[model samples]
Target: MRKITLSNGDTVEVECLSCALTSGLIESDGGVVIETDYLHAHQAVAYRIE
Candidate 1:
């Protein structure tokens, strides 16, 4: 599994071998956008721990 830290300090775990479409909210310099990817592609999940 791979991890990606968002600008808002959120960490997401991505599976390289998964085949399922996932959805998550992303915060970028331009603004916030909803990110989605196919099941076959790498997926990212963002969530706050605290």
Candidate 2:
């Protein structure tokens, strides 16, 4: 896994291969996941981490 600190002071962990396939943003307690077209054509549930 790879880690990054967002401008909002949130930490994100991304799988190496999936990094390019996903975008993310920090939420209140966790974060939201943005899936790539290959993952979903429609808006799917955003992944959350605690």
Candidate 3:
């Protein structure tokens, strides 16, 4: 897993691979299973919540 920040100053703890495959959880193969793009994630949730 890694920490990724967007231009809006929002941070997310995700696993990004090849700048395409991104996910909240790490996949079996160093790739991410993108469910929802970070562009939609709210600022409430973050790399380390509370």
Candidate 2 lDDT tens digits, 1-50: 76755444656675642343243332323333444555523222233334
For model 1, the superposed segments whose C-alpha errors exceed 4 Å read 16-50
* TM-score computed on alpha carbons, candidate 1: 0.31
Q: Residue 2, candidate 3: how far off, in angstroms? A: 0.6
**Ranking by TM-score, best first?**
3, 2, 1
What TM-score does structure 3 among the candidates reach? 0.32
Q: Go through the candidates in order and give each one's C-alpha lDDT.
A: 0.39, 0.41, 0.38
RMSD of 2: 8.8
Residues 1-50 of candidate 3: C-alpha lDDT, one tens digit per residue:
77766434555565553232333332223222333534432322223343
Estimate, for each residue in 1-50, the C-alpha lDDT of model 1 and write its tens digit.
67766545656566631221223233333332344452223223333334
Model 1: lDDT of residue 17: 14
TM-score against native, each model = 0.31, 0.31, 0.32
At residue 3, candidate 3 shows an lDDT of 73
Backbone clash count, each prediction separately: 2, 0, 0
Native RMSD of candidate 3 (Å): 10.2
